[model samples]
Structures are given as C-alpha cells and as structure tokens.
Target: MTKLKLSFLFLSVMSLAIFVACSAETETITKEVEVIKEVMVEAKSTLKTVQDRGTLKCGVNDNLTGFGVLTSGGTFEGFDIDYCKAVAAAILGDASKVEYVPLTASARFEALSSGEIDMLVRNTTWTASRDRDLGNDFTATTFYDGQGMMVYADSGYKTIEDMNGSTVCVLQGTTTELNLDDRFTSAGLDYTPLTFETNDPLQAAFEEKRCDGWTTDKSGLASKRAEFPASAGGPDSLVVLAETLSKEPLGPLTRDNDSNFYDVVQWVVFGLIQAEESGITSANVSSMAANPTDPGMARLLGVAFGDGKVADFSFGVDPTFIQNAISAVGNYGEIYERHLTPLGLTRSGSLNALWTNGGLIYAPPFR
Candidate 1:
C-alpha cells in the first residue's frame, strides 16, 4: 500500500476512537445525574434537623389520664410519654432529651403540620381523613382503643342504649366526637352533645353532673376513672360502657414529606413489639446480640451477622438503635403495663393483645 493510503486509514481509525470516547463520557455523565436525583437529599434532612436541635420535640396531650397527664413534678407520664421517650432514645440515644409540647386535640395536627413538634403521640386516632388530608403520616398503632360512653354507675345507665336523649360531654376535634354522633344517630337516639377543648373541664363537668354522660376513648375514660375521688363516688362511680363505639389505633405522627423520619418512627414502634415476641427483653438484649445465632434476632438486635459485615438495615437509624430504644423503654407490653395497667386497662382479649394471642398487634419481621 502507498504511504498516503496508510495515513488515511490511521486518520479514520483515530476519528472513530474520539467519537466513541465522547459518547461514553456523555452516557457516564447522564448516569451520574440520574443517581444524584435518586439519592433523596431531603429525606436526610429530618434526622439532621433533630440532631441539630439536640432534642426531639414531641407533641402530646396535656391532660388525658392514661395516655398523657402531667405529674406534680410537671413531667408528663403515661403510655404516650413512654413512646416519646422511645423515639428520643432511638434518635438521640438519650430517652430524656425531649421537648414536650402539650397540645389540645384541636392543636395537635396543626402543631405537627407547622413543624412546631417532631411528632404527635397524643392518643390521636389513625383515620382516613387525617392520613390523606392532614399532610401527616401515621406509623404503627401503639395502642388499640375504642370510643365508649362513661357514665356515673348510679346514673341508671347500664348500657349505651339506656343513655339515649341524655346530655354527653366529649372533647372536640377527636374521633370520639364523630363516633359518638354516629352511634347515637344510628341507634335512632336523640342526644345533646356538649364539647370541650380539653379533658380538664370535660372531666369537671362530668363530675359536676353538668352532663349525664361523658364520652371519649374508653381508655381515656378508664384513666380518668382511676383518678376519680371519693367526693365523686371514687373510681368505681364511673363505668365505661361494654359497647365499643369505634376503633382507635393510636401511634406516632409525623409530617407526610418526611419519609425517612417515618421509617425511623415506624421501626421504633415495630422494634418494641418485635422485642416482646422474640423474648428479647432489655435485660437479655446485650447477651442476645453478643453473638446471636438466629438470623432474625441477630439482625434485629444488631448482633453478629454470622458474616464479617456489620449488620446495617440502612433505615437512616443507628445499627443498634433498636437496642438503645428497647433498653431505655421495655417491650410494648411492658410499657403498656407500666403506664396503663394502673388505669384498670388490661391487654387480654383486647385488640391491643399480641397477634399470638388473637389480637391485631403484630410487628413485621425485622429481617
């Protein structure tokens, strides 16, 4: 071949090489952009926000007996208060590092939506409207409850049907209100509904006989009944009716946009229930995790993976977050008994019972 023909062939090959390199570089750049889009930087913002604040701001009821009520020391105590501590324990590793925002039923969702609080665990029900319209996400039903009527034992009202056309007091802006209305109307009973913004005045009015019956979540009634005084015929005076009006599955509440935060709160809830089922108490967690042979238990307790790699679920939580949380707060049943049992609430035969016991309280597998 001539030298000119050899040079022409070399130039064509060089041109093809340059074109392929440019196309490959362009494809690589496009993939980099797509990966950046998928990373969801905003999802990390919630964890960062809580960390920066140095405390989790929890919204809670100021005066619901079993769920949330302030002690003489001004510290809140109840089933709801324990949950707030669990979230803090999971996020900050210190259960006490929390700013409690006491909110009325009407103000709880507003506070959550406006970012005034990190979460609301104020015995709020998980309803279709709140889940879809309130721009908030509900995670795990921490407590299973039902709306019911609370009447003075001597009021001659043995059942809900006996109280028709009577005056009933209930807190406004709760499922209890709507449930009460529906129950009475469905039974073709005409009753007067009196509303309160909080439980303090609502309980006062019932004790004062301002209303013939007080209606709210049955758990709330039990808590209030536990606190009743001898002047008002004591706790035995008020009886929560046998008929449960509506289902109330209470749990953690966060803004809908914070999906990462949602996962963190939800798993924290699941962690408690799972801990109970696995027989992994706070006492046994450390020993169990030191070298758990069970794959699911190892994953849940962040024990040895039986492989060299550290167990990481990658749910924007610490590998040992469940351990920290469960250690700070015991399993779900323990928390309930600690705060709610004194209120005459029991887990047996209720929806709050474990799934193994024929109830709805089952947690998904951690593995």
Candidate 2:
C-alpha cells in the first residue's frame, strides 16, 4: 500500500460519495415537483372550477315535501329547492339554468366531494364533526330546526316518555335516526327504529300502524302532517312532541377548498334575509330599485348613479345578483310563509326568527 495508491483510493471514494449525494438531491427535487403538480390539479378541479364550466349543479332531496321535493310535473320544489334556484339566480343570473340532482342522505357528501354536484342544498344538518372531518364547508344555516317525535293523535302518547316501547319510523342514514337512538338510550327506554329510504314509504308504514310513532325534524313533521291524506283525519291527527332531541342547523353545503363558491351560496341566503330585514319584498323590489336611496339597498341592488361603479364583489356573481334572487324567490320570511307556515309551523320563540327578535336568523352586513 504505497502513498500514491492510498491517494487514488481516497479520490475514488470521494467521487462515489458526491454521486450518491447528487442522486438523492435530484430525487428530492422530483418529489417536491410532483407534490406541487398534484396540489394544482386538485385546486383546479374544485366546485368553482366546475361552476365556471357553465350551469350550476345542485344536489337536493327528491322526496321531502316542503323542503326538497321532485313533483310529478317533473319540476323540483321546496324550501331547499328554492335555495338552489337562488344560488343559480345569483351566480348565473338565470334561476332556471340549474341542474338538480336528487340525492339521498347517504350519498349527499359523496356526490359533492366527487363533483357530481356543484352544491348541495338538501336539508342537511351542520355539525362540528361534519365540518372538520367530512371535507365539507357549510354556509350560513338557512333553516334552524330541531329533532322531534310525532305520534298518532289517538295513541294517547302525550310525551316522548310515554312511547318508550314503541316502534319509531325514521328515514335511514340521517341524523334523525342517530338522535332517536341517543335520546331513547339515555332515558333507558326500549324502542325499535323502522327505517325507510323515503318519506312516502315511511308515511305509508306509519299510517297502517306498522310503526307506532315517527321521528324527524319538528319542521319536517309539520310539513308531512300538512300533506297527509284526509283519510288519516288530516294534518291535525298527528302530534309532534315538545321534546327536542337535537339541534339541526340545516343549510347549503359546498366542497371544502372552494371559498368563492361557498361565499356565493352563503351570501345569496343572507341577501334574502337582509332584504326581509330592510323591508324589501319581491313585489316592491323593482319600485325600490327605481328610487334607490338607502345605502344598503343600493349596495344590494348594485346601483351606481355617482362616482365610480360599484366594485364587482367576486363570488362569480353580477353586482345585482341578490336582486335577481329576491325577484325570483322572494325574501326569507316570504319563502317561509309560502312553504313552511302552511305546515303549521311558526317563527316566534323558535330559532327561525330574526336575530333582533332573539332567534338565530342573523345575516352579515351587505357592504
């Protein structure tokens, strides 16, 4: 082992080390580049991305009356359905441009995540777990509802406790069923859940005494009662218990990561509330726009008579998007009265009243 031989060996080892280090660095750079590409691809495929592709696709319940029902006339109608139209009216300026995809509770989230629907306006409850873990971003709550139990008027069941051993009919895969299980178990009561896919079959089973009671949102029970057949003694024959099993803040759901789309849906709902709060109804909206002095009204209507034109408030909507919404679907109270009030529900003392009235229906300032 001469000194020259040892020097040659050291040079060889140094060259191999440099080669390995450069190879590892190259691999790291490649991996980082791949990650950035993946992120960009995902961001481009979001709800706003697809909505920009033309029509807004809305996911709604197919069978729940007064909330989201597909009529035999082939048109979708209900409280939730109107919100879908409102979103379309705001974003696209044409309420009729929306494509409605009827979805079940079990499939709602999947549809939104997979881009099967651009937005979901179904009567879905917003919860902490769903917000953080379900990859969804819930906009402002459009309907504040509570879970309740309903029994036949002739059943002699005055309260939930009285029907401890009864078989309860509930739609499967809903928060309603989960709440029913929680309340009954906490009370050490024995009950069986007769679950169904849709309300029609559930009501049929309930009418025939296949289930002793029905459990759902109080608002939902009222809606079902209003539509119940006269052969069952009409709507007054069903009674919703006073016990509220759970809090259900129902609203529009958008995919997580599309802040623009989320804002559009949220503000459309808020616009309706703000319109109602400002004494602007569907009938007077056109007249109000003609005169337009109120600052709130001006901002809402996208008016610009002096100085610079109003800045386009993004959300991929025209400045007068809300005005179109009001003209198309009316204000929050108007919608509630048209769809919910006839179902024997009231806004007083409930979470549906305006915030100034001590309820939860508050909206962000339009400006």
Candidate 3:
C-alpha cells in the first residue's frame, strides 16, 4: 500500500478503539452512580424514621415517682417524661406526639435495643458498661442524682451506718440495688436487700415493715415521701438519709449508629439547659425569640442565619426545633421545679445545677 493510504487506515483504527474505550468508561461510571444512589436512598430512609411512624415511642418507668411515674389517670409524669416531651417537640414540633411505653427497670435497655422504643428516658443511669456494651447511647443527663436510703422518721435512723443488720427494700434491675449493696458492703455493714419489681409493691412491703429501710435515688425517695399515705402522716413522716451512695446521672438514651437522631435527642436536653442558663423559660421563650440579640440564643431559636441555615446542623429537626421544645415543655429548671421540687427534692448543692453554679449541667454553644 502507499504511505498515505497506510496512515489513513491507522488513524481510522485508532479512532474506533478510542470510541470503544470511552463507551466502556461511561458504563463503569453509570454503575457506580447507581450504587451511590442506592446508598443515598437507604440513608434518607432512616431520616425521621421515628416521626414517620407518627409517634415517638419512649421507654419509661411505670412506678418511680419524680422520675418516671404513671399516674392513676394512666398518664406518665416526672423528669424523664419531660425529656421525652422535649425529644418529641424537637423532632415532630409537637410535644404531645409521643407514646409512653412504661417499662420495668430491667426492660428499659432491651426495649431500646430491640427497637421496641425509639428512646429510653426511665431515669436510666449512664454507666460505661451500659453505654459501650449494651449497644446504646446516652445522650445527655437531665438530672444529677445520687442514691440514698429512706426510712420512717420514727425509725430514728440518721445515717446508712445506722442500718447495719437491717433489711432494706430496693427496686430490682437497677443501679440503685447494686449501689445499695456496694455501699453497705464497702462499709462492712450487713444488711438484707428485699428486691421488688415495681415501686407500688415495694412501698406496700415497706409500709408493712417488710424491710427496715427503702433504698433508691434521693430524688425518688423524696417523690415517694410527698405521695405517701396521709394516714402515715404524709411526707414529713419519712426522711432521706443524708448520704449519697452513687452518682446517678439520669438522662435520655437512643440506639447507636444514628447520629442525626442522636443529635436531635441530645440537643433537646441541651436546649432546655441552655434555655435555663439564658434565663429563658417556657413562659418567656416567645418574647426572647422576638428580640433575640445574643447570637447563641438566636442560633438556638433559629432566628439568626449562619453560614448555613440553622437547620444545617442535620439533626433531623427544623432550625427552630429547640424553640418549639422549650415552648412545649419548659426549661430544665422549670421542669425540675414543676415535677421535682414539689416532691421535696432540691436543686442546690447537687450535680443538676448549672456549670456556672459549680454543677455538671452544661450545654454546648448553640452555634
């Protein structure tokens, strides 16, 4: 063949080869794009998975007063109940969109891990074992509590040391029981633990003198004191021993791996604490939103726009989600006063106070 004919034939073959290579590359890219789309779809499916189900299923205690009490009207109340409301308000923008599943102490964690509830807020203690080994995440502590023993005023017991060789009533499947055992054992005091599943049955046994003492969180003992039978001379008839056995940072918890949902639950608690810190209560949240000059407050209330909209936090919540939460359920302090203080529990000198006040209740900057 001539040189010109040979060059033209070579160019034609090269061009055809380049076209096939480009087509193969395009097919490979298309398959990758399809895979990415599937992953994205699966991810988005998890967003608001609880809300899409139309109710926030919360695991709570059925008997512990001032923490997770079920009233005679079949309604749940107390500190844990308020945090559940905060979660619902933050996610659904309506606090009442919650279904409380009253769980026993032992059932709380399993209920959460099994997806029987979206969150557990049953005055659960956040321990390393429960957080790491139980496959759950403790968001934030709403209440700083410590275990104590309660006895009838007439019993004349002033300290745990006085309870040596006495029978103590305790709730089963709780850190309270373990703490009671450890406190007594570490002090070389011999005491019998009468464990019961529910507080009602336990209280009944206590009233019947089945045990010489009742051991639980100080706040819980206070709550029971306020509600004790008037025939038993009411709250003044009982006394909480002036000793705290263990640090019980009771808070809300969710399943692990869902960071977005976790943030929503976490910040609901933080928002309440932040609101209390900023002097914003349920009664004043609206007015503060109307004239929010503080950057932190504005960002929290979704009034100030940042590099991204406030909702860019990707917590599966609206920008003003916290504002809604505060509006629905009061701030942390208000919740404490409304539910706890009435039961004779005090906030002073406890871990539940604000960090500025030398307590552990601190929140991250809203920004």
Candidate 4:
C-alpha cells in the first residue's frame, strides 16, 4: 500500500483506541460514584435507635433459671436478665426500659440478626463461628462455665465414664450438645442422646427417668437442681458430676458492624467489673460518685474528682452511664451473688471470680 493509505489507516486505529479508553474511564468513574453513594448510606447506629425508642430490646432465655427466667409473677429475672437491665439503665436511664424477648438456643442468633432484639443477653457461648459467621459481636464473657452431667445421686455415677452406654438428655442447639458428644465419644464411651429443644420437656423426661443423665452448662445444671421440685424427687436427688467438658465463656452479644452499640455493651460489662474491682457497690455507688476516691474511681463513675472534669468516653450516652448501670444492677459480683450463689455455684473458686482473685473475670481499663 502507498504511504497515504497507511497514514489514513493508522489515524483511524488511533481514533478507535482513544474512544475505547474514554469509554473505560467513564465506566470506572460511574462505578466509583455508585460506590461513594453506597458508602454514604450508612446503617443507623443501634444506640441512637434504642435511645429514640426509649427501650432496649434484649434477647434472653426464659427457661434457664439463675440466668434468665420468666417468673410465676410474670416478671423476668436472672444473671443475664440483670445485664439487660444494666444496659437499659445505662442507655435509657431506666432499667425497666428493657423489653425481654425470650429466645431458644437455636433462635437467639436469628433474633439478634433479624432485628427482633437489639441485644442478646442470654447464656450464649462465645465461639469463633458465632463471632465471624453468625455476624455477631460478643461483648465480654459474663460467666465462665463448663458443660457438666447431672445424674440421679442414687445412680452411683461418679463421672462421665460411669455414664457409658447411658442415655443423656441435652438441649438440641447448644455447645452443650456438641461438648457432650465430644466427651463421651472421645472417651470411647457409647451413649444415646435424648435431645430436647427446651428445658421443661428435658426436665420432665429426666424426672420420669427416661434419660440416664442430664447435661448442660454446670451453672445451668445447678440452676435446675436448685429449683428441682418435690414431685420430681427434688434437688437432693440429682448431682452434677465433677468433670467439666468444655470451656463455655457465656456473655451478651450485639449485631456485627454495630461498633457504637457493641462498644457500649462491651464497656458496660467492663464498667460493672471495674465497679466491683474498685469496691463500688450498688449501696455505695451514690456515695462513691459523690466522692470518688481517685482518678480511676472518678473516671469510672463519670464523676468529678477534686474539681477535675468528668472522664467521658463519648459513647453516645451520658458520661454517668456506668453509674446508672451500677445503680440499677449493682456490681458484677453483686449480680452474680444475687443470682448464681443461691444455686450453689460458688464464685470464690470458679472462673467467674475476679481476676484479682486469680479468676478469668478481668476487664480492660476504662480510660
């Protein structure tokens, strides 16, 4: 071809290249704009939503005693229930501002993710899958528990080994079920599991001797044993075996990606723990706030110490939020003693004891 024909073809090709590059750049710019818009539409923080609603919707277990239970008098009370109240008091300034939604083991995570509850304060174990796959943020482990087996005292069951080839009753959707299998199966013990979705039926079955053993968190076993009725051979008839199957660090959980609400829940737990550590009781919280002894105490109580400004974390609530929580439910120790001690789950030698007491219950610094 001649030079002129070649020049014309080159110009046409150059024009086509410029048009393609502009089109790609324009597409990229449009995509970037869409992303910016998507980023601009942020999810409303659960904190502001709860504040505006004037109540905290807390998911809890109504069946488990000493943790969360609906009473015969139509009121909810327990170790977990108190945390609900504490969060409510901290956020809404009224502990009674909580609406407790009773949830089963399987349904609790759904309730939280589906917005059926703002937070879950049931005896939920913090697991890797739950924190990551389930889209949840576990606050602190309020109670350190382990799975145990409760058997008829007369059954002469000394340990898990004794329960070989026995039928065990367990909650269907819990770590307890998994742990029970792990224990018995790993021990090379053969057993049949009688899985129930709720406690009442399981308790009834155990009462009728349908299952050779009942198993759950030791705290749960103690709670059930404490409330064992006369018609069912009473509390004395059952005994929790000494073998602890798994480490169940139970606590409250909020929806994932909700950092504001998660932080509030997490720190409320820490504050209560700090309150106990600082010797601030519900009875003396008012006095302590009025006169905090030191900088740490003053910061925790959100009070002025010797004319210093109150330490505020800007948690989207009043600085005295911790004080409100403490006033509502007392310290972590008080809450535990009020609920768990009566069940005979002593805190002195357990993981639930304060870290200072050589237990796992430790809180991060408030400041």
Candidate 5:
C-alpha cells in the first residue's frame, strides 16, 4: 500500500476512537447531573418543608379548657392553642396559618409519629419511657400540672382515702389512668376504674352520676369544674382532691431525625419566656425594635449596629421572627393570663411561674 493511503487509514481510525470516548464521557456527565438534581430535591429540611407546605400542622386537645378547647364559634382557644399559634407565627410568619388537629391522649403520639401532625401541643406529659422509647423530642415544659381527683362537693368524701370502693371516671389513654391505678393500689383503696375514650363521654358520665369521681390533671379538673351544670349545684359542686398524683410537665413535641426543626421550635418557645423576662410586650415591641440598646434585645430582634452588622446565631429564622410571634400572642405570661387566668388558675406561687419567681418557666439566653 502507498504511504499516504496507510496514513489516511490510521487518521480515520483515530478520529473514530476519539468520537466514541467523547460520547461515553458526555453520557456519564448527564447521569451525574441527574443524580445531583435528585439529591437537591430530597435534601430539604423540615423548616423548608413546612415553609413549602404553607402551614404548621399542630396536634392539640379539643376538650380541656385553660389549655385547649374548641369554642362554639368553631375556633380553637386556650394556652396550648396559643402556643400553637405562636409557633405558627414564628415559623410561617402568620399565626393563623395553622391546622389544629384535636387529638386524644392515646392518639396524640400516634399522630406525631406518623407525621399526621408536625407537632404535639396538647397537655402531654414528658415521661422517661416516652422520651427514650418514642422516636420523638420534647421541648421546654409549657405547663406544669399534676393529676388529681374531682368529686361532688357534697359527696361526703373529703379525701382519696375516704373514697374507697368508689368508681372513678378517667380518660383511658393518659398518664392520669396509670396514676389513678398506682395511687389507689398503693393506698390499699378499692375503686372501680370507669375508663373513657374521650372527655365528652367522661364529662357526660360524671354529670349523670355514672361515676362517683372524675380523675384527671388538676388543671383539667378545674376546667371541668368551671363548666359544672347549674342543675348540679353549679361549679362549687365539684371539688378537686388535694392529693397530687403525678408530675405532669406538659410541653410541645417534635419528631426525631430533624435537628433544624427541633432547634427552631426549642428556641422560639424559650424566647417567649425570655421576652417576658426582659419586660418586652406586644405594645412596646415596636419601640424596642426601633431603638434597641440592650445587646441581647438588639441581637434578638436582629437590629443592625452602626456598622450594619446584625447578630447571626444561625438559627435559620428571621431576626424579626420572635418579635412577630410576641406581637401576635404577647409573651408566655400574657398567653397564660388570656386563657388560664379566667379558669381560676394563678401563676404566682405556682409551678407555672417564672424561674426568677421560684417557678419552672425559665428561658435560655439568646447569646
């Protein structure tokens, strides 16, 4: 063969091999791009997920007053509901953008575990078993309560011991149920357990005298007592026994495996208490924001300094988020007064008071 013919053949083969190699490289690049896009789509945190969803799904109690209750106007009201609203304000920038799911004590955990609700704001107790066993996390205790028994004031039973052989009505799926059994058995008292699935039935049975006593958190008993029928001798007809059964440290709950969402919730709640401690209220929040001089206050409200640098704690929330929440619902104390105070519950000298005043409602510093 001629030298030119041989050289031409070799060049053609080289070109063909280069074309195949480039085609393979392009195919690999396309696959990697697709994978990266998929990872990006799946990498969203719960905060972002909630933002995209446009509302916070909160699990709450629909039966109890001073904590959670549905009114005749078809709206949720009370302490737990306010906390849900405050959380919604902080995260979604609108307190009204919330879906309140009324749940029973037995159903609250299941709703949270299954992602049916983003959070549990019902008066749920934080137990060691619940904390360690369930794939969930508990934030600061919002309300400090204890289990107690309620009976007719004229029932002639002054104490739990005096009620031996009496039938007590109680919710079936709650810490109250266990406490009732434990206290009665330990006290060597014989009492019939009238278990109920929900509060309506329990309240109905109690009103109809189907049970001699009603057992629940002391705060719940107060709520129920406030609604006692005039035909049943009015609210004074029911009296809560003084025996404290269990420490019901109630609070909000979040699911596990999402650290960002947890941090957001934890800090927002603590911030409410902190705001109250700082004497910041909805009425004066605007002035504080406009002329923030306190380092902590300025930092919390995201006030820019002379150099235009605002404090960044990396919480993934707007600096104005806490202020907005406070403005919408006031601080924790305001929330309590608005709902609980009317129920004949006082914060002073109680477990729900501030830490400075010898109570458990305290907050961590923003710094």
Candidate 6:
C-alpha cells in the first residue's frame, strides 16, 4: 500500500473509534440525567405515594405526653399526634389512615431522609442548622416553645446559674443539647450533659438522680412533669425553671426538595390555624362547609359563597383538604386545648395563642 493511502486509512479508523467513544459517553450521560430526573420525580411525589399506599408513614414520638405518646390503649395520642392525624386526614380523607413510626431524636431525621417515614411530626424543633443542614424542610411551627430546665422542686435551684456543676439529662443529636451547652457555657458555668438517645433512659436516669436536672423544650418538660409517675413523687415534685435558653419552634418536617408534600403539610397547619381564626370547629365544620357565612369562611372551608366558585389552593389534594383536617382534629385552638391545656400549658398570654389574641400563632392568607 502507498504511504498516503496508509495515512488516510489510519485517520478514518481513529475517527470512527472516537465517534463511537463519544456516542457511548453521551449515552451514559443521558442515562445519568434520566435517573436523576426519575429520582426527583419520586422525591416530589410523597403526597401521591401516601395516597396510593392507603396510609401516611408519620414519624413521631411515642413517649412525650401532651405531644406524641403511646397510650395504654395501644393507641397514639397528643398534640403532635393530632397534627399527624390532621395531615393524614388532609391527604387521605381519613384520620385513622396513619402508620406511626416512633423515632428517637437522633434517628428522626434519618427516618425522614431515608423515606422510612413520609413526614416527621415528632416534636422536632425547627432550627437554622436543622433546616439547612438536614436533608429536610420544616413546615410551619406548630408550637412555639423554648428550652427550659426542670429540676426537683426542692432542689433550691431557681435559675440556670443556680445549678453550677449540675449534670443535666438531655437527648442526644438535638438542638436541645447544643442549646443547653450554649446556655451554660455562655453563663461561665460548668455543667455536664448526660446525653441519652431516648427519653426513657433519660427519664430513668433523672428519676434515679443520676442527673441533677432534666433539660428540654419547656413544652416537653411540661409534658414530662404532667405525667410524672406517682411513685416518684408525682407532677408536683418537679418544676420547670422560668429561664428559656433558646427559641425552639417545634413543627413537622418532610424530606428536602419535596415541595408538593411540603406544601400540603405546611398548608394543612395553616388551614387549621385559619379554621380557628374563622370560628370553624370540628363540631361545626360540616355545617360551615354547607353554609359558609362569608367569602373568607367559604374560601377557608373550600366551599362556595353566594354562588362563587370554590377557592382551591391546589395542594395536590381535594379542595376540602383543610376542612377534612379540621374535621379530623378540630381547629388549632381545639387541638391545643384538648392536649396541652390539661398539662397547664395555658394558651392565653402565651406564644401559642392565635394572632388575634396577641400571640404568634398566625398563618398566611389562603388565597
């Protein structure tokens, strides 16, 4: 063969090989993009998954009374549990269509990020680090709480400074632990944190005097104190100090980038708050839906007012999603009164009260 012919043939062979390699690389890239898109679709479809699966997997706390607790009757009940039921009813139309997954503080975020639970309503606090670092997005702040110290009533400790060198029982992998440290460290006080992954052991340790005090959200402290076993000197034996260490806004959360499910969860909370503001109650929700008095009420109830069209916010569920939530768990005030009021967590003159009543429990406009 001639030199020119040899060179041309070599160029052609190399060009063909490069083209094939490029095509294969392009195909691999295309497949990767498709897989990413598919994962995103799946991530955003938590609402549909819950609906089609016939149940919502809700991560909760099965120990904190007045928030989320497992009762002796083999059922879950509390403020946070009611929020779970409210979300389930909003999405599934049935309050009972919920599969509660009890998770500890350390494991709650993993349960959510791993899809072990569709939503987490386990008294999880909404903090900057949790919102940005964790692969999750907190909905609304269902309860405005603060970190508090609960010491034995006779411990003679009136403040955080009073307990210098104290050992405090706190849950691990929570902002509570960090905030406790921040409080004590900033006060130039020395204390040891007896961190436990679960509250059962922490409570046992506290009861056994392994720790001088127990620290968590004040609402949690109230819940724990309210349910203090009679054999351990009962509720009156403990008192939550007046010092609030941090602003802990407790709420439900969903996996990050799941905006559809996030919207449903967020607005379900707003709807319940709006229901309370609109004077809608579980007992009167049906009648209000049937005969909404004004456009605001009609829009809130997802009903027509004076022949106008129903105002649906399109939360990937029925227009009456809020109505269903309210019907299932009553309004926000009702839920609070039912679960928290008995714990002596008064609503009046507190942050949990409605905005109309000079509190921070306000929701955005539905329209």
User: Which residue runs does candidate 2 get wrong by more than 4 Å?
Assistant: 1-51, 305-308
Candidate 2 lDDT, 131-196, residue by residue in tens: 878889999899999999888888999888898888999998789999999999999999999999
The model with the greater lDDT, 2 or 6, is 6
The models' CA-based lDDT, in order, is 0.83, 0.82, 0.82, 0.89, 0.84, 0.89
lDDT of 3 at 19: 63
TM-score of each: 0.89, 0.85, 0.85, 0.88, 0.87, 0.88
Model 3 Cα shift for residue 26 (angstroms)? 17
lDDT of 1 by residue, 317-345 (tens): 68888888889888888898888888778
Point out where model 1 deviates above 4 Å.
1-44
As a whole number from 0 to 100, the lDDT of residue 367 in candidate 2 is 68
**Which residue window of length 10 is worst by lDDT in model 4?**
35-44
Q: In candidate 3, what residue range of length 10 has the lowest lDDT sum? A: 38-47
Clash totals for all models, in order? 0, 0, 0, 0, 0, 0
RMSD of 4: 10.2
Best by TM-score: 1
Candidate 5 backbone collisions, by pair? none
Candidate 3 per-residue lDDT over residues 1-367, each given as its tens digit: 2347546655655565566567857665556555554444335332367768867998988787778877999888888898888888888888888899999887788998877888899878899989999988899888878898889899989998888899999999899998988888999999999999877889889888899899887778877887889886777888888888999988888887656778788888898999999998899999888788577788888775334344346565688888999998889899989888877676888677889898899999876
- Model 4: what TM-score? 0.88
Better of 3 and 6 by lDDT: 6
Worst 10 residues of 5 by lDDT: 36-45
What are the runs in model 3 whose C-alpha is more than 4 Å off? 1-47, 305-311
- Candidate 4 backbone clash number: 0
Which residue runs of candidate 6 sit more than 4 Å off their true CA positions?
1-43
Error of 3 at 178 (Å): 1.0
